[model samples]
Target: MTQAAAYSAARRKLHWGWITPPVLFAAIIAGATIGETRIPVATVLQVLGNNLLGTDYAVGRIDAGIVWDYRVSRAVVAACCGAGLALSGVVLQALLRNALADPYLLGISAGASTGAVAVTVAGVGAGVISLSVGAFAGATLSFLLVAALARAAGGGMGVRGAGVIVLAGIAGSQLFNALTAFVIAKSANAEQARGIMFWLMGNLSGVRWDDVWLAVPAAALGLGACLWHVRSLDAFTFGAGSAASLGVPVRRVQIVLIGLAALVTAAMVSMVGSIGFVGLVVPHAMRFVVGVRHARLVPASALAGAVFLIVSDILSRVLVPGQVLPIGVITALVGAPAFALILVRGRAR
Candidate 1:
């Protein structure tokens, strides 16, 4: 094909890429309508429209409350968490140039969990900092530690350095996980320990609209920040030396992108504990659908991740009927096999 025609065809494909987001939105709506009470789709729509658009449409007060107050908020939180985590994965994979890189893989989740556990179990920062703030601080500290260790091991900018970073991350994760466990074991009452355990396992139940406000904005901002660095990410895929030669300010961009990824991971984990697999698997899945270009991959991954988690959250609710499973459990069950398949395929290749 001629260059212009090929460009046109690619643009057309990109336009078709728009379909995923709408489908995800539809899935979110469908998920919101499902629960123990089983709100109808039409009632859910009416409630959402009346609240969001100031429409005159009416629904049963209980149904409206369930849809508008409970289910919608939970779904939004799930979507935001999923999108943020997946976007974090995309950025980290590009920054580290490692297909296996994920938000949790780098100790961010462990750090967040540690910080949260410290607050909940030990009350270390109870008066001074909230759990969410503590989690963010811990996540930031973990990323800094990993970066510093990787740099010390041998500058964290190339393939060798990526390996060092991964090793450092594993060490950091283990350390934080140990700290979290110690805090829970030593200080927490049985009830507190159970709550901590449940949070660690990743429950989205009882999330309020307040959480929606915190999570959605953070996720949106993080995604915007990552998208802003798309050119830099693209440049880095060729190596730090190549990116620098292309005027990408390789180290600065890497730090900024990684920090953004950490921020997204911290935000989500703070609200809902460390849910796994969305970050690890969603990016790869979206890459298969949208190709490897960061511009397409980032947004597509965000939408797909949102959809994946929303559906997973619904399954978590309905799986046992009247009892909710931890959303993280569901994701791990799905993601582990998906990851294994990816590994097997890679080996075959």
Candidate 2:
């Protein structure tokens, strides 16, 4: 390719890379904020402008009640949670050097669930912060154990060496799940048991603004780390041998990136109870749209992930006559088919 043409093409990709995320983020935020008393587009904008200006005046006020309670909080939680999980997935895919790698493919979700269940069942823990802390701890510890075992099993340190750890995570996750069930069942407080159940199903019913801060730093950190390492991630695409020959420090980068992804996953799962597929499905889909460059892919995945979850949460909130389906259900619905397609396509290739 000619230098000028290549330069122009690269510039175009860069521009779209930045533009797509905020656009997708904005649309999802607006759509999810629209519920029964659907706010007109113009009104939503006015409220947005007023808030950005730190004013009491809103752009448009529809039904004051819906705006105050259900829609706004739900939209915020969905955006944060979606971005967190999606970014985690992108980093993880690079770490594993596997197109199929997902955020929860490690035992993080299971361990996080165990920690969250303990908090809900025990009833003496600090609300969301305590739960987030416990979950992150559990997730990190589980991955550490699995990765350590994989290193030993592989006779070296690298993604291949860590492959066995994936299996270990699966086993560990099953044990954690069983333990979570037992812990909740034995809580012995009826209200605590009910809370535990609701948490397990995953709902945004009571999501407060406060619960969001826990995820923000983790998501930003993980995505930032991945973006910084985009070249290294791309090098690994050709396989570990190629990456190492290219000075990728394949093992060290793998460890750091995977760790970051795990932290992001732990943070989100703790708050939202394991929303699925944004990580697995969104990144792969974005790959088709934007190509395999991690720089573009990471942000695109973040944006797509946000849009996917916000819409899914909207569906979960409004799907039934009088009840909301857990957000996890909608994600699972979208993710399962997409995941199956990825697997099938991989086989075809």
- lDDT for each residue of candidate 1 in 1-349, tens digit (9 for 90 to 100): 6999679757855774678667866987977888777878888888889998999896878888888888899998999998899999988888788887887888999998888777766888657888787888889888888778888888555667778878988988888889999999999889988887888978899688999989989888977887788778888788778888999887788777787787778878888898988889998877767788787787788887888889999999988988999999999999999988877876786
| Global lDDT of each candidate | 0.84, 0.72
Write the residue-wise lDDT of candidate 2 on 10-79 in tens digits.
Answer: 8866886678767865765575355544666655554655556666653334443455445665677777
Q: In candidate 1, which residue pairs get closer than 3 Å at backbone N, Cα or C atoms, i.e. clash?
A: none
Query: What's model 2's overall lDDT?
Result: 0.72
Residue 271 shift from truth in candidate 2, angstroms: 1.5
Alpha carbon deviation, residue 104, candidate 2 (Å): 1.7
Query: Which candidate has the top score in lDDT?
Result: 1
The root-mean-square deviation over C-alpha atoms between each candidate and the true structure, in angstroms, is 2.5, 3.4
